[model samples]
Target: MALDSLVSNFFWSNSDGSGKIHWAAWKNYRNLKTREVGTGHYIDVFKDPWVPAAKQFRIPVNNDISVNQDMVVADLVQERSWNLQPINRKIDKLYLDLISKIPLTSSPRADKLMWAPARDGTYSVKAGYRAKTSAIEGRTGVTRASPSKKVDTRIWRRCASNPVCPVCGDETESLEHLFLLCNWVKVAWFGYSMGIYISPRNIKNLGFWLEEFQLLNDSDFDYSKAYVASMLWAIWKLRCRMTFEQVEPSPSEAMEMTNRAMKEYWEVNSLFPKAPTFAEPEASYKWRKLQSHTLKLNCDDAFCKKNGKGGIGIVCRDSEGLFIKGWAEQVSAYSAFHTEMLAICKAVQLVEEWGMQSVIIEMDCQDLYKAVTQCSFRHCPWSLHGLLIEITDPVQNRSLVSFSLIPREGNSTADRLAALA
Candidate 1:
């Protein structure tokens, strides 16, 4: 069947036009000339998109044509060969050449429809949309170029009232300045680059800078591209925030936002299997036997910044190292440290509810360890002050309860559970 006919039939049969919005959308999308024919059995030879030179094969208007409206390209083929005598006499040489070059099989099959812009002869919505956009851009004399150039053109044309950088409040806002040269953007890029251990090169051209990273021989080259793209997007968003909302994010906050955005992009776009979480060497940290008659609780927290939520896992084991009871819960939190503090607090509440006289709480966060050991909120961020108070209360009320820090490898089970939760 012809692709358009198939689509039209599907929509017409499935839809009731009670709401005209959906029907209008379907009709608009169906009208887009995005499909080409293969084998040419189902498509109209003169009316449908069958020839490559033009969207449809054009018939000479001055010449008297005797073909039926229902006729297809197959009617022009006989005995597994093109009946080119009549076609050559009717159409121009360019289209005739396109039709003549089409390969024919001894055993013919039904014609198929394929996306014209796709390499694999398969359909892709993205490719079709891009082709449509390119056509529109071509007609307007606007070509795909660097965003900086587009912005500069707009500024020159006085399309924008002000062209200054919103984040830095200095320098004309071009793509280069927004992404790399502005002081605020520079700080964000520096922090992201340092965290990933990839030094920023002193390249000014945005295209060359991006291309250089993409051409690197390192295994993380794609990840590097994602990081750069994320930073660029974050910088744009920061500019928008400043311009529209009149709010500025700190450099650290901007970097964090960029990292979280990159993580989300990877999760949605990744095709490879997820890499295993790295663990410290087993020899570096081993689980120790709990003191006699005391229960040991291993707690861990997994925070997903995209959702502003976290998972907590707490597993209690007897002094002999056998599992007693385990619990996992989801909680709201702003940061990893906050989640860790909440997990510790949950562990304490569980211990107190069980009426365990002597219990040891172990976790994998060194910051949380220091906060508890120092008995001071100096090391804790202000966001965790209230949770820290709640956490310390349970510890102080129970004379035998204590907090300890263990390496992540030693807390593998709890970590796995937290991830699952």
Candidate 2:
């Protein structure tokens, strides 16, 4: 196709249509490409295809008064950088973000046309088929309602640009580097109990390693396939935040989102099994008595449904039922479980601060009691993981801590204090 003279000038000729029936189909795809700018001197600003971050490898027209069609890319270049003064108010915010991401070259060279779909700029028939298939079915396996009008933007960015890992400044971003090797991902993996340590040498490749981990879901292991899917989705969301919204990447935020994703999957799955969901479990109304030498600490959360505010109350008493120390305050919380967790952490902090040797922690929330006492936090709510980690950390050896569940009536003193706060 490159050796024919008529086909060489076929894309740019607008006046010739006699032999354009098949040529137009080729020209339509030819426009869906980009050129690597060298000096930015010859490329047309709007007419020519550039900016692979946008649709069709070109910028979209926005409804603005400062539209300029008679300009080249050189008009917006100053001191080897993009001069936003000429086009800041001329484009939409979404398109402006895409334009700013396009890197500029300082050294003088010829403008090179690039095939944006392939990893390398040069095109092949195999790459064309993969690109067309990705357009129909998404690269990340998300189901789309309308494939033609809506695009899988995450896959689009992956194809258009070669970017480094934003969380860790790695030189290259591959599947191995993105999921397994990055330091930020290591911290996230540690969020689960005992953690997963991946040994690359023992496995053949990434596929074999993931398949081995996935098979453990059906075994007696606590780790499940839902967590694997959640991790992949969370990592993709982190990349999207940096790519589209320009938000800073956060490891804690990523873990929280992963927990939320797993929770959503469990909730939907529970519907089929007909598992009963309850605000509080049916428990014995009696309160267990503590040892005469031990101190008892009671904590409760008073959450306001209207304003989403919460009151935390902590009361400590001796085995004789004599009040020793009481703390109450109003604070902001994400959910009722989160508020209860925050109060528990505060109670533990008070125990450590007071130098109490032996104490029994009591609460009205049965779900949290089981989560804390059983040493299993994999199925906890989204925001409670961090607090659970904190509560589980300081109690390793300093204080003898035992969790107990009580009815709302038995813990009325702490409940009243929480309401008063």
How would you encode candidate 2's per-residue C-alpha lDDT over 1-421 as one tens digit per residue? Answer: 5658676566345554232322224464675477766666778877887765567767666655757887778788788677867878777776665555344544344566777776446667766655655654664575543452234334544563766766677645555556666777667767654377655465334465677877765684434677877887897788777778878766687788888987888787778876577778665465446687799899998987655578999999987778999999886664687678878888888887998878988898888887777655543542234356567667766647777887787788898998889
lDDT of 1 by residue, 38-135 (tens): 34577776667655435433433324656556767777788876787755666677566556534444445556554445443354656555655665
Candidate 2 local accuracy as lDDT?
A: 0.69
Q: Which candidate number has the best TM-score?
A: 1
Clashes of 2: 0
Per-model TM-score, in order, reads 0.37, 0.34
- The residue pairs that clash in candidate 1, if any, are none
- In order, candidate lDDTs are 0.69, 0.69
User: Runs in model 2 with CA error above 4 Å?
Assistant: 1-289
lDDT of 1 at 281: 42
